[model samples]
Target: MANFPLNRRQLIGGMTAGALAPAVLRAHSRGSAGRAVVVGAGVFGVWTAKALMDAGLHVTLMDANGPANARASSAGESRMTRGAYGPDEIYTRMALASLSDWKALSVSAELPLFHAHGVLFFFHEEIDYFRQSLEVHHRLGLPTEELTPEQMAARYPMIDYDGVAVGLFEPEFGAIMARRSVQTLVAQMVLGGLDYRRGKASPLTMPRGPSPLGAVRLDDGSQIEGDIMVYALGPWMPQGFPDILDRKIVTSRQEVFFFAPPAGSDDFSPAKMPGWADFDAGGLHYGFPDLEARGAKICFDNHGPEVDPDTNPRQVTKEGLAEIIAYRDRRFPKLRGAPLLETRVCQYENSSNGDYLIDRHPGYTNVTMVGAGSGHGFKMGPEVGRLAARVALGEDLGEPRFTLATKGTTQARSVI
Candidate 1:
């Protein structure tokens, strides 16, 4: 799927009319009519609601957290939007489709949801992983260019490419404003007459003969019945659905730190400093341009200790800050002495296989499950939501890819 420009009117139509509080309530009430209950208002849930509304279904979106709260994973500032799948062609295809949907949704929501500043994968020497990434990009026909160390330094002078041998640059890959995207999707859902509810859903109460459908009991014993239920709950997967409790979906806490860019560095802005990932260190180290001008946001890919989403501390610790600082000093010499401005933690609801689990509940047809996005799932949330909606609508989703079922397994609880 190629990227298509969004229409101007659609872009303007995505803005919210009133205050966010009332608009969310109104959206929830308006969408409660026809009979679709989408649990979880994270990025996936919001987009799922929008997609359902577009398909003419009265969609009700539910989440345990309050509106636009940072409790969930989608509350982060930015998420990478890259189609260079690094040997996962299926994901690449999905990313291509997702890019198209993201553009359309962005226009409809009237927001600059995407920032196509591109991604630069750095390495000290040519390795098999780089070769695989290059092959995947070539196979997908994505616009990926190989750069020599000198070429990369010349083009992206901000990077410290002292010992770098080669770089892979994907011009179309960039970042997405995750929170804005979710809020915009919810706003558009409201504009399109979708309902947004704030609560946790209990097990479904249904008739005996047919598949389990209708009426999700809330935590407060209140029950809201709908024809279809879409479980887009992120890390709350095990909390909501007990059947998967025994499944291995480990929740881990990860932190990203923001640093003040060096003075007089023109390339520190989003337009000049693209998202970067270095695979040379045997651990994933990535960074994004800070939107607040505090500094470039950077973090390691290593998983933190398992945490319960409800009570675990979401604040970064001094030790975590030290690790990030050490990374800067070791690899990014130019940013060695940068001042740390802020740090925040986010949860990763990862599966055992490191793949997403988007499928109909094995025991129930009316209940659709979309979760365990693992760490890499956010980059593909829009498309995942679309696929989840399709499943909820009783449409054939074709073959599963980047999913747990692909390996003939129902769930792999923890990948990290």
Candidate 2:
């Protein structure tokens, strides 16, 4: 574990490198006598504050909404949780390491955070991606098994395997109760004595002092000051920090639909269903068990339109719903034409490189910027939170997990 505790000098240099406003320096000085302030009370923000508090730092978590607010992605009912990553070896390792932390937190919070129901990758024909995924899992010592179409149909009768060529199963894979996890984390933060504030944070003036002095100006012009700041504002970051707008992060709007399975298709129930991802279609097809009474959930992976995060997320169009229904009809005939119960639109703050950005601000050492979720960040939220906390504390990041592309190397293409 690389732990880099930020000293006064390093903090100043980091802030300068990121070209942050001078107020950032004054607000984050270690010499300041105050608690650490985490902006945005989403999963990342709350967990970051909790980590800091556990490390003996007084924490003040400020967010625009209350816990599990719909404005944040962390409010989703569930997120697919799996560890059989293909070429992304680093992410697989991070997930494995995070399991312990998640389990510990689940126990402490007395909440069921994970469901080890396994995951099934259904593919048509012998695809290279599937082969590569199986190879990678084997090479990484992960438990995985291949199934023939007959075997798959026998095991998962709900799946229409008429044209399916192969299936890959990872018994260790599962799903996470995302909203519950967020609630648990927030509860732990409160239990640990972290202060909570609800308000929008704008740039604020810093008090004149030699010590670190930062203030978050709220909507009412009231300022909340702190010794150090953690910028976990998620998609709202672009408005708060405009300097890095062009450097790569952008918000994309995605929608998920829930539908009632066809009558007699109880096999799709949570007790028997595992998460499924299909690449046989032109695009990625992913779905999760609907454990929150919202019906079986399904969505296209990385095929959403770009949008501004501040706008309402309820603009899902009739065309979008049609596309989803068509997908279900073609790939999952059982759920085809099922009654649509609900739809959820969420924003993904993506990086051009398709990897997470968990580092100190180039110009502001005292402030750490956490964004670029890249669509697949929810599963690793706790690990990313831990890493963000370590960065804020000035701890050295150990071996990099995923292959993070720098601005110089990343091309001007969509992350998907």
Candidate 3:
């Protein structure tokens, strides 16, 4: 394990970001402190709550299972952070911007929330996403080192590079402590005077008056009202605000498995191996370097069957389990029979296209809706939160692609 504790100088820099705040937070800081109610304690919700609180707003953050609940999409050990979005430079830059904020938050908290161990994408010749990513990375000046199969085998012998035709190593891309980071952010915000509540958010109840705003009713029969209400319920978005997100957002069941490495196997450690994604697989399957002798984390990223977040059984299906074992055997032959350490079934809020849905509810301007992480949105939490906070504060982010109108009923996935 590496110690990325904040140094004195880095602490000063991060502290200055607090005084000046980020551009998005600064925009809201100009106004008087407004009372806002934020539903959900996932990455997007926490970051949005923190941004609003930082901008001098009194925020009441509510969640069913507290911060980074096991049921939440953001509750995971490690999340990949990469700028290789194929042709989507929008997310590429937004990811970089979010990384800056993550580093700053790590400094402020003095904890290593992000690990820049780099990410390797291996692909076969027919994989068009590889070339598309290279074009975007090259245009954005993101550093990458191309590798041949032989080169990859010479470097990472653990990975079976049989079908790997082209390899790209992005040194700046890395992984973040997803669940820990979200919990830590929420704790810090609470300590910084945010009102953290524990309860599931019910539908918004509109007051019978000329006012455009409404109060968020909790499952506890408690009504929490605010000048602005942000519904960032992640997969629960479609369930809570059906009319707005009915066909626009879908929640899918995702499965992840951790395998015990070979006895005395330091080869799978982060120092030796970086995070890797094998596009050569039939679908997207990514891995994190072994973490502290626990296990090697591997998960398939292709959208799974649509599920209801509230009632669906959150367990890996036998078919999905067998498929992952087969994938592991094919991609990493050395860890074929490793003991299964753990299996986690998570719900991912996905859009028809993988782009996030961040826009105001057409009926209410003050109630900003944020979600549809689509599995790839966790790394950009800070930027997304900034945008959400701005919108909740009544600013037009002007991002048409993220608007609800752009989301469709058909599941023609494009952006990764």
Number of the top-ranking candidate, with TM-score as the measure: 3
- TM-scores for all candidates: the values are 0.85, 0.83, 0.89
Measured on C-alpha atoms, candidate 1 has an lDDT of 0.72
Give the per-residue lDDT of model 1 (tens digit) for 249-291: 6778999898888788756788888899887655778889766
Tell me the tens digit of each residue's lDDT in model 3 across 1-416: 12224332332112223332233244446664667889999999998888788766789999988788887899878888888887787887777667777777666776678777889988877467778778877765667788899998998899998777889898876788889899888888888899998887776533343344557877778788777888889988887876657878888888889999898778888888889988865877898988756599988887888888767687788998898899999889889998999888887788998889888777764678999999899999987887787777666666798898899988888987
Root-mean-square deviation of every model: 7.0, 6.6, 5.3
Which of the predicted structures, 1 or 3, would earn the higher TM-score when compared with the native? 3
Candidates' C-alpha lDDT? 0.72, 0.69, 0.80
The list of candidate 2 runs beyond 4 A from truth reads: 1-34, 104-111, 125-128, 203-213, 263-265, 398-416
Cα lDDT for residue 399, candidate 2:
39
TM-score of 3: 0.89
Error of 1 at 327 (Å): 1.2
Clashing pairs in 3: none
| Selected candidate, larger TM-score, 1 vs 2 | 1
